[model samples]
Target: MTAIPSAELHTPDELLANASAMYASGDPKLFRGAILESITALEAFVQRTVFRSLEGRLDPLLVKWLEEKTRMDFDSRLSVLTQVATGLPINKSSELWDGYKKAKEIRNKVVHSGRKVTAMDVELVMASVRDWLSYLGTTVELEAVLLTLKRWVEQSPKPPIENEAQAIQLVAQYFHQSAAARITIEAEINTGGRRHRADMILDFGPRKVLVETKFPRLANNVRNVIRDAVEQADAKRQAANIGQACVIAFLRKRPEGVSDVVERHKGGGILSIAIETH
Candidate 1:
């Protein structure tokens, strides 16, 4: 038989250009794995460039760029970047960082060990990577990725929690009953001069307690609500003959490290109760 010559593959840069073209043409999945591989390659390139430029003396320009990009003080940028290299999102970024990390692990497994990559896996990794890229203003092939991610999310086996408002109401009821001695329960206090309903209030005979009930998932939002409630409570207390006043957050579940937070602000008469439900 006559010998046939096999064509040589393109260079990394050429492959990257081809991938970019495919992405631009709306064929994102055509070279999804290759694009991710390119990102890995680019990361290595950035690291090598940094190391080569920094030989012994650090470049002030590079230092300034790093500081500006991260919005961090000079001393913390290097440490923060080291953590970021391990796939921590920049700026303590998103609640989905854990999900992104899990997706990245799957990607690494597939790429390095030739493991089977499922559609779901690819979808998750693409979504997270695209989000991170968009946040950083980096170019990403999003259309196809988003489509795949949507499908994956739609096909996800978990059932969505329902009646979040009802759940919060239940938690508020629990807290009200539990603290009946020191706290007086009042529902739907119209405040904010707009008939805004306060979920529950704990009435201290002399000093009033404003309780804003929220789901455990909205723990961060509770902080601002608590702050506003504190100010409002103080205003109400001042307008009356109350001795001390504060706001308490009654959550469906305790947030991590929240007990310490409660203790820290307990001196200020503010309380946060993380309600445990059966």
Candidate 2:
């Protein structure tokens, strides 16, 4: 998947970029992925707005319940978000509401029944997604919510890593907290002939970064390890439609000859960084 540089994009734009890429891919799974991201963008937006509106006064248990409820299946979640946000009942009279409902049906068809989705279906969903985004943006409170998220990203802490698992955890947490990138831990990606579990994935709209954390053993072949890491990163990138990869080697002790920060491997296919755990 081709991606525009996302170094300057806000969270929502990143999500939209992913949606656009998926819609353009001409693959059913890609289309489905696009639809899911589109909906997820709205869900996150709405949830943040709702939470902001409540002003940290909602009961802890109630807040948790609301969060879970907001995460219900697409249709239910959308309906709840619309109703809570607008205070207007979603009836047949509202074209935007109806359009979202239709989009939900299309998503279900592709996801549930293994039905082939058409380009038109993707177009319709995109339209609905845009409509929802626009609607949310028009409101002052929701717009403030969006700005808050962007600011929070600007103020986020750098990820701390001391071990292999912590490296993956901290990297994932860093992207998500700092840039509104969606983070997935231990996600399995198909590597052509087989599947491997990626330590983490940082999804930023059209572009994704696959991350791997390795704590190599004392007797492991260093050359072979580096070669395998580069190849694995490349394979996972292709499988996940990701454009970039980061492989972190948490060694028990710093190797004598290796560079601490070798930025890219195989001509930028991977970003290989090594850290000493001593």
| TM-score top scorer | 2
**What is the lDDT, from 0 to 100, of the residue 123 in candidate 2?**
86
Q: What is the C-alpha lDDT profile of model 2 across 1-278, one tens digit per residue?
A: 11112222244454488889887777776877888778777777666565443333346587677667657555564565445543435565689988888888887788799888677888888888777765543332322332343233223443333455665554454455446557788888877678788888766554566777676766245546666887988888888777667676655555676654333465455656555544
Model 2 lDDT at residue 236:
82
Q: How far off is residue 45 in model 2, in Å?
A: 2.4
TM-score of each: 0.27, 0.43
Q: Which stretches of candidate 2 lie over 4 Å from their true place?
A: 1-14, 25-29, 55-57, 73-77, 81-92, 140-278
Worst lDDT run of 10 residues, candidate 2, spans: 1-10
RMSD of each: 23.2, 17.2
In model 1, which residue pairs have backbone atoms overlapping below 3 Å?
Answer: none
Whole-model Cα lDDT of every candidate shown, in order: 0.40, 0.61
lDDT of 2 at 82: 45
> What is the model-wide C-alpha lDDT for candidate 2?
0.61
RMSD of 2: 17.2
Candidate 1 lDDT by residue in tens digits, 1-278: 11211111112333245435544455435445644654453344334332222321246587556645755332243235533322223444454555556665786676688776555565565555444433321101111111222223234443332444664444344344332224443444434453444444544332334444434457656556556666665554444434333333445444565542221132333333333322
